[model samples]
Target: MADDLRVDRMTEKQAREELARLAELLGEANAAYHRDDAPVMSDAEYDRLRQRNAAIEAAFPALKRADSPSEQVGAAPAEGFGKISHSERMLSLGNAFEADEVREFDARVRRYLNLGPDAALDYTAEPKIDGLSLSLRYEEGRFVQAATRGDGQVGENVTANARTIGDIPDRIEGAPDILEVRGEVYMSHADFEALNARQAERGDKTFANPRNAAAGSLRQLDAEITRARPLRFFAYAWGALSEPLAETQMGAIERLSELGFVTNDLTRLCDGAEEMLAHYETIEQMRATLGYDIDGVVYKVNALALQARLGYRSTTPRWAIAHKFPAELAWTRLEAIDIQVGRTGALSPVARLSPVTVGGVVVSNATLHNEDYIAGRAASGEAIRGGKDIRVGDWVQVYRAGDVIPKIADVDLERRPEDAEPYRFPETCPECGSEAVREEGDAVRRCTGGLICPAQAVEKLRHFVSRAAFDIEGLGAKQVEQFFADGWIAEPADIFTLESRFGSGMKQLKNREGWGEKSAENLFAAIEARREVALSRLLYSLGIRHLGEVAAQDLARHYQSWEALVEAVDLARPAAQAHRAGEEAAEAERAAAAAEGRGARVSEARARARSERDVPEDAQAAWDDLVAVDGIGPVLALSLSEALANPEERAAIDRLVGKLARIVPPEARAEDSPVAGKTVVFTGTLEKMTRDEAKARAEALGAKVSGSVSSKTDLVVAGPGAGSKAKKARDLGIEMIDEDAWLALIGDA
Candidate 1:
């Protein structure tokens, strides 16, 4: 695993960038796992990413993105099936990787409920199945509908496909008039192996694991295909109910069993966290013998009344948590190491290994993270793997939990070949022969070739036309690669000029291989349709670092037009440069002071520089305005300003903008709402709701939620324990209100 940034030492800028990267990576992972039924990364890696994201958010709460991974349950439903709107949202469970975390979870629950330390709390522990989540709805004793857990609120209707599963009863007796049963749709190990053998015999594609097979089988478009496959369902939860099922979690599972549902037999009721951990250990020991895949053990508060009081976070239940198991390990021989350049010009190292199976998946390639990882040191100079550097032709231990991508866990130096030598990382990009430079705080070395590098150019073009960008109908990744290879398109602007350049004549697109008259015409039509796009999409399509979908939307809402945004960037460039210079000077002064044992002068130097810096008032105002745009921070603003200041980048953007018909601004704000168009700051602990809930509510009411109290702030909501921010609000004379007053204001709005 890669060495993660320490939450305590991470700056707000780094936090914002890390959050953006996690959002994109986790979004893709969710789509692959929930919607496509083929996970791209392992379960441990996914859990690690989520944990890192949560830690970062906790450290810098105001930097959370609107589309944060912490608030997402699952990916949106795939296209082929009909969509079903779930009556009650199917939320995800929080995870615990260690015994202490489990104990902390119990303590948190007790704290939230204001119970004494010796309060009696019972929890039901059960194995968390590694399979697809399905919800079966019954109306008046008859199973009326079945759907997959897709993006929580909405799912794909799989009624016909679900009915074929033998474990799911068609009707039930002694059940509520309206009961929505939720459970896992899975395939046993024996069934999965047998199914794979049949698939191989028929020369069809084999599954990677039992979970994938179960998901693939249950989501089949043809009901007959689903019926031919072996699938099972375990009932453990419910969504909507007309009446109470039971008084406790254990009683509810028994009710589900009596209603003709197949419930897992390993379910047990535990007294507290310690008992829960014991049950988890028992389940872990029985995992291989259980005949089904279970990734972790889930513990839910037993009392229904306590659960009702606990309620939920935005995407997870507060009354339950899954204590996940560790990764599975195997040894493999490292063949070679390769560096691949990404869209952002990052040169990432990958390890090619001899085939080995770990956690039921065959592994041949693993991420080396960065050059520092290969050198056996973290970015902060901490020794890892006992300072054992990785070399080619060495034996390495690989681990995988549930992710498709496995990682190297350790190296066996004794098994290394005598001729093996320390690997040398390239200082130049292999593709473009350009110098690769690693920035001071950055972990990866990036190519300096920019658009001149073929790899970066193709990747940028691909991103420009990605699903969330222009999304031209016939211009997929393969098309982009082919066009770039033929020198037909080299940049985003070149995409908009395709028809005019190759619609006819000897260089025509129709003349190309695998191209027909209709297809070529359709491609041109698709490109034409994207001539007009939303402002946020256009900004995101530029592939700016730290500028994600949410950030782009925030920028769009603030600037409203391309011209306005460009002008602001131009005006703010000088002020951004001055700020950078001041920071650099302060650092230099501190270093000099430390070397001379004159620590007292360090503060004076920094204060003098801040008080004497020469920056135009207009430019400073422009910089302040840009940074005040809710999610936009100094780091992101500087990146954007520098991009526009670059000659080549500016020209490319200009050319692309020239071809656009119109750039639509964001929707108008709700003028009637009291908080609409106002910049609001939240401070201290919110008693009525969580901080995230308050931020969401404010944004929904058309108000901008700033992280800190500023002169532009129109309102500040201060709760108990508010300190610096509350005083600042009072000093600035911003309208200060309590949590109840805030609730009243929004309620009346």
Candidate 2:
């Protein structure tokens, strides 16, 4: 009755019943492990079930289904990617859990290939990455489309985002006529942790593990967001081939590697099952220290001839086997949701859960990401979710790994008490009492208090200190948030005044988390050191709406002096008034039309003229001029003119001008600067600094920045995001440089 026990020879009907039972159990177990990363039974139990399935299949050859579990090697596809047609359908591999199974597999393969007992057969071994599966399709040598494995028959189209990944070659050198490569999309451990950290910082949901993280990232509807996530892919198989390659498996893999695909470096050729077992054992022992996610090692026949002869079962082939590793997740309860404010004004809701241990780490809170997600949970009729208002007493399932924030997997309907009602969200900002409002097109709600809101103030200050911004050596987001929470820092100006708070007690600031004595001093030093920043950076640090570094530069260049810019903004009032007068005149015309029927065109035109005659002559003149600036249309002119009409803003601008230096014309405009009239592209890692900073500098110096590297690119600053750009640049024989080299050329160092 043991599951692993070999089957007794029987009638085909009896064998079919065993096959049905075995397939059901095996499929469910595999789904549990593959989709959820949760296994209901031990590996031994699974092996036993699988052996029963194989025994049944062996006895009843004609009774198998095309998609039977025994024939499923590793995984099927998921929805949300483009469906790719593989020239050679990518087949799954059959598995062998024990030494006996491996021997039987070898024997069957040898027999099919007509090999005698003395004949030799070889195999290859490679560690299987735990991640989302995808197929890359190329036609006529250009990198074009990539699709996720959605039920094997179809997938989601992610070509745009897939194009952004630098590791995936846009074009292989001396490319083939048609190439379709299969691989696993995974996140490196470092990237996974970093991704979680970023999500936590933004008050958004974090992925439970690297596999889910990679899958979720690829499935995103917004390609830009996916492009931002740290995802990597490694090719393990070939589906469609344009031409034939070396006669052996090792040779095909070598050829793939040479063709610019990231083939697994661990692939090894073995003479028999003994060597394959030895290699798998070695990989199993070394699994802990690998920087990336790995589930198991795959073993495949080294020679294509042997594999073809061995043949296939409905879903899987006789060539390969997946030896799975262990699981890495823990479950806990959801208690409450707390809102977090990110530097960019994104509001994130976090799930406060009971503590859980995953991958040796204790976790209690998971990010809900945004209000939309929380609301979606409520709509799902989850008892703990309070139907839309998560209350204090509800129990919810929290999933975690090494991720800083866990994910709410389920709500405990049985644990919902009678007193618990749906939680209510505050309409006002919790910190500053500003109206909490959700904008028409935004996913997150916000406190419109701007500089007055404690959360936004800290977030903005932290953003100013970010590496791409001012790169303040000591100030981090946590430190900024703590300072804002403690009332020690209310604005960017307060960062310069932290010394005043120190007299009260430096201990409070130091122990506030993400803050320390050395860090605080370094932060102050950084603030002081930035006193001489270019006008553009100082403008960006202000965190003003519609005002980025480029805009600031444009403003600075146009006005020449900060004081003049303020005066121009003040003088711009006349133009706004003029513009408003025109609008008023238009409105009056419409209103006058109601005075008479539509038949009197001349009368209506006269009435409109009369309405404008009443508008103040000077106001009409000012509004007209405001509408003339390039890119400054009627609406933009009115908005700028109205906002600047405030006496307080005028005063603040006056005060700000006194504390800053004027950027000389040479530095202000890019007209004749270093890169002016030149086309420069940024790719990969810049040795001098971040790509953003480098791009900004280059742009300021008059260079045009393009996303792609082309024949016309004057220079290519190759860095880490340098995927296709590097290849294209190299192919076109364009000049490339590292960050340091760029800085040296620009004389920035």
Candidate 3:
């Protein structure tokens, strides 16, 4: 059934069947895991099935049923416990399986905030304990009630059971009048083993895992029973607050610690995605030695204001994500190698492995990344295989985490077959017979056939209507494929004309097999709704190389209008070409002069190209302005400019642009404040406002607030506890101001 649920390539009928099967399996699993405290399925298995269900639904949107398991969290509150309704919802964080996804999460927040690529976004990374989520409500700094995160919106009333936990304070002082602290309650491994041993001695049932033991102990009907168990709590977040706790996430955690609530000591402030991932790896390495269970590392936007601006999605916050560690690893035989073509024509290799269970999830396929990965070499030319390359018929270690695709970890040369030969990657796309070439400094082998390649065309079309694109309600990947196969739509521009062409004809979409009258109408209406899209979405929909969501937003913010962006790209293209040609000609002249022993002439030619004043003023300025946009560095700028420069690409874009009603520009921040665009850093303990408040106020006043002091730092606000950053600012001769000075500068003194 799991094998049959590869819904990415499944037909509509197959998707319907798989969704129905998944719903049934997941419904029972939820009951067993949440209600009965006896899980019939592993966490890995549950996550995989849920992922498959979501994929199937995404492909066949019309077939999505309301009772879908993907819409659910934990099971409804257990029968015995009283239910409590939360004022503010307790949502879960979306999972990131790989380092790139974590980086994407950070970039996404920056894009939403319209920040420069180089702008620092501080993050609080902490251990994601594998325990039941508990929300404790306090009134006037006194603990009033506590509840479990039963189904996000409502939870079981475990206040009586919660009081027994020693880590939870009966009352907190110097806190907001109305505060609701949310955190995890778990039983340590030692405590769990001891409790189980005691239960065995008393001829009672024992728990399977620490998480289960903790949940069962907390949800017990007898309060005394829960009081006897060693259940601990770690406060990390909050719900409804009458007054703000702290300005930043880390500050709030610190305040919680001061109020006598236990917080994870491993929590630290991280600067960027790389630092966050480094901390994640550190936590993963120490996971086995930790006294309690933690499945992953959770990263949240440190700035409370930023977190507020990047608000909640349907069931998760957009500003935070959890990076789950690999759940399990298993050795399996590499059955074969397969090549898959992406929307961008990149040919990716996949490893087909014999079915094996890793983390209780059956994996028959794993991503080989690219050709270099298969040959035991890193993309950066580093050795990875330790003298044992992966090959067909070789035993390979496969690892799985969260719902991400399995990956090949290592190869067992001891079990390799004698007759196996080195695997050769295809020089042409398997879907279409086209020449595949790996670009310089790139690991991927891409098809050069462009639109002629069916794989690339279908994938691009599918992407055009994906959630992050046009997001037509009833038309999904499967629908897009169906329409493409029927020749109803060939390009994005064709979508806008769909109704006029086929809305009332004999070839109308309603007459299609899978589509009904309502669904067809819904799809057409959705398409029409997106006729006027945001400039950022339009740029992202183009799917240009290296121009991701973040880059598109940066470009959109820089060029406020669609016409401005198109004109700029058109103008930048020629300038870039001229600049590149000039550099090449200069290099050639330098080489020729050096060959002839004319050292002075060679130096002069090099200087002409290198000097700012020697180049065409307009061309140089255009290039400079293009790269000046935050996040749009030289490489990305070149790709964007060239993509717009291509005649065919330009023609298609023009057609698409003509069809749209208008491109909405990003909202501009107020720039009347004196501190607008000034880079300011605050250090030490701020007295007038919380660190979060100060950052938010500075940002509101149009200042670019930085977390650290650097040479580029314009001003430093040193508080009473000023430290190294203040010293650095002083050393660099940067203006040092106090809180009062900052207020005076902002004209609030």
Find the candidate with the highest lDDT and give its number: 1
What is the lDDT for 354 in model 2? 54
lDDT of 2 by residue, 172-259 (tens): 8765688887898888777887899999988799776677787778777788998999888898777677776568888888887888
Rank by lDDT, descending?
1, 3, 2
Clash counts for the predictions, in order: 6, 32, 1
Worst 10 residues of 2 by lDDT: 377-386
Could you estimate the TM-score for every candidate?
0.51, 0.44, 0.48
Task: Flag the better candidate by lDDT, 1 or 3.
Answer: 1
Query: lDDT tens string, model 3, 1-749?
Result: 33443567788887787788789878888877767777776766677777778778888999998888867777788898899999998887788878999989988988899987788889999999888899999999788899888878889999999999999998888889899999999888678879989998776998767878988899999999999999999999999999988999999999989999999999999998999999997776555457677878999999999898999877789989988766686566788998989988899999887654456344668999999899988987788977457789887888864445799888878768999899899998898899999965579999987777888878888888877667778878888898899888777898889888874653467777767777777777888889889888898888788888758767887898988877776666656775555555666666677689776565655554564345566666778898889988877887888778877767878899999998889766558887888999999988888886787578657777788888889999999967558758866889999998888888751
Candidate 1 lDDT, 1-749, residue by residue in tens: 12255878887888888888789889989999999988877776788889898998999999999999988989999999999999999999998989999999999999999987688899999999888999999999999999999999999999999999999999999899999999999998778879999998786999988889999999999999999999999999999999999999999999999999999999998988899999997876555457777878999999999999999889889999999877576566799999998887899899997654456464668999999899999998899999999999988888753345678879889878999999999999988999999975679999999889999898999999897788899898889999999889999999888878764653467778878888988888898989999898999999988888779989998999999999998998889888776656666677677688887465756654684368788998999999999899998998899889889988999999999999998776677788998999999999889997898678768998888898999999999867557767876778999999999999955
Q: Tell me the deviation in Å of residue 249 in model 2.
A: 26
Error of 1 at 685 (Å): 34
